[model samples]
Target: MADHHHLHRSTKNRNGFYVKMKFFRTKNGKPEKPFFVKHFKWILWFSLSFYFFAKFLNNHESSTNNNSLKTSIINHSHRALSESILQKPKTSHGLLNDLKVYIYELPSKYNTDWLSNDRCRNHLFASEVAIHRALTKSDFRTFDPMEADFFFVPVYVSCNFSTVNGFPAIGHARALLSSAVELISSELPFWKRSNGSDHVFVASHDYGACFHAMEDRAIADGIPEFMKNSIILQTFGVKYNHPCQNVEHIVIPPYISPEKVQSTLLKSPIDGQRDIFVFFRGKMEVHPKNVSGRFYSKRVRTEILRKYGNDRRFYLKRHRFAGYQSEIVRSVFCLCPLGWAPWSPRLVESVALGCVPVIIADGIRLPFESAVPWSEISLTVREADVAKLGGVLDYVAATNLSAIQRNLWDRKLRQSLLFHDDVESGDATWQVLVALSRKLGRSHRRLRVSSE
Candidate 1:
């Protein structure tokens, strides 16, 4: 067969060139793993679908940029706490703008002899340790109305101390602390009165003695606009001479209490049994017919009880029972009559209970800065000299009451009737009540040019 048909056509052209070189070495030649594992499983499924579509578009742009930075910090903290509670600012110098009045806490409604059995029928007669030494440690029930700039508050409630009911009762005036619970709970939007400002009352002592007997019942019962029409009233101490403007003491806290001489109502003047203690009681009117200092204090207490009638240590008290500490430690002296005149509280509780006060009264001013060393203590007298009170009780029976001269006469009677020793009239009445509360927080055309 012509060489067997050329060796069978050269073994069928070398077996069809080895099946086309194994299909071009598995489609192109080198990368061959079982046909290059079927084209490497379509290039690993298009590279895992483009790496999960770029990780789902970068996690949806990182959750929309973390919810736009938490809604821009909650709308800038709700527009800064709502413009700090709507522009808060009522007086105290539009809310403390450099105000400096320095500590004061008054809280009145007096009466506290376990709620009264008639202890000095209160009129704001102090004693909570003289209102904690006049708020020096700052507690006035609990002060801090934003570190006060003005706070006198005593429109008049009167304290007769009673609870099983009988005379002008109601009490409690709070504020022990915690910033007075944001000042009496209004949450201090600068004590709003439309941020205009006004607050201060302080008039008592019979409405600063006749503000026309309570100014037409405080302007037809509302007490002349209670507060905030840019408030301003200001009548405190020296008053009652009536007939127009001058009143202004207001620096309170000396209603007697140097720990009322360690009170427990101080009884032992020899365990009392009336060794003569008499601070008046009930229906008192020693003789008030037309009160010309009433029949000379019962004709000078009946000539000192007819010159000490059988000397049971003679006595005569009243001013509602001389605010007791055992009637001023079984008093050796203290008559202080005036039956209510230019001054009272018997010239400050018989010179803060070391006793020896006599006074009598006629135009008595005697608070201090002048004739006070009364030969060491006190004994005024004159109301047309009640027949020279038996020669001033024979010169107080020839003087002899010493306990180291009654502790140097109770330290010169607490430096002349303690007004906390005139700290410059309590810093000029707290700078005239904080300049009339910044002149009623101006701007009604500056309060009509400050009330003209």
Candidate 2:
């Protein structure tokens, strides 16, 4: 019995020794016998346990390193993807380079005789795109649809949304995609929704009367399709409307600076500051009949000038700068009046020039926060209250010129809301545009296939 037990123990020790030799065998050496045969039982058990533990640790280290390598490769690949895809010609020129897009700029009938109030007359004062092209030094090539990376649809305010058939139905769709109060939810009908990505409707509220009304219709008609197959909705407005979470207010490129404009006009003394009071810096021509509330100009401008001209109590000198910044710096205040509703390019330029802007329009939605106090920065004048106009101007003249000048340059509201010449709004806009472009491209390919 004792010999039987001894044999079993010997057999177990021999197997353990064989395993250890198999693992540790060197290229130049033979298998070595157990160093301590007396403690063979304890050593065999310990060696077997140690072998498995060591193997587990090696495997764990190798696995950790492989996973880290895989993660690094994935990160590097994603970083290169945007740059590579953007290099494709399809998405160049403010359009996503890798995307296949077709932009059709819908020309308005008002463009033909934009200067004449008879034909181009609308509730708005300014002429349409054709007029803008003639007046401003904008490139006519921008409207060439063949050269466009994405279809450009110029949306305007019409009294009846459906009655206005501005664009041809064969290739393009009317812009009914406004991101306003009426359009902000998931619970909406399908007909109003834009189904494919091929068409992107930029719901901009830059124009005064058209903003709220057009966007209300667009949201009601669009939210449903946006849920299924989304189209890009680029909104640029001061007021935040429906589905504020999804809508991205694209920054409008700042207008040419007074210095650059002066250079273009070839005026001398470009650096010289012009301080002229109450400059009528916008488009002068207007249709008399369509003038309503904010759209109508109440001859309060003439009244203020005429009143100040005769007033001896305060030596108020009233003068017009002919929309020229050269003479604008001559006056302490730049009287910026809104035409019908609340938007005018003069307000933006006035602030940029470090002049105190006096807003005369009643319903003009103030852009800056009420807390930081724009009263410290600008003057807000009521449209009809000609009585308070003098008081407001007097108050502006009383404030410290250095503080006001400093506020204009260092102002957070002005910086955040307004666009500067150096900063490009293209990147954020491009991100949204790319997503929509891909969506539209996929839709176009799918439609082609289905039709086939």
Best by TM-score: 2
Model 1: colliding residue pairs: 33-36, 141-175, 141-176, 142-175, 142-176, 278-317, 279-317, 279-318, 280-317, 280-318
Error of 1 at 328 (Å): 3.4
lDDT of each: 0.40, 0.41
Off by over 4 Å in 1: 1-133, 139-247, 251-255, 258-260, 264-272, 277-327, 331-333, 337-359, 363-382, 388-452
Worst 10 residues of 1 by lDDT: 170-179
Residue 388 in model 2: shift from native, Å? 2.8
Clashes of 2: 23
After aligning candidate 2 to the native by TM-score, how far in Å is the CA of 442 from where it should be?
19
The CA root-mean-square deviation of candidate 1, after full C-alpha superposition on the true structure, stands at 28.4
lDDT of 1 at 147: 36
Residue 112, model 1: lDDT of 32
How do the residues 97-197 of candidate 2 rate in per-residue lDDT, one tens digit apiece?
43333322222331232334332222222222222232122121122222233333333322222335441121112333332212322222221333333
Task: State residue 16's C-alpha deviation in candidate 1, in Å.
Answer: 81
Query: What is the TM-score (0 to 1) of candidate 2?
Result: 0.41
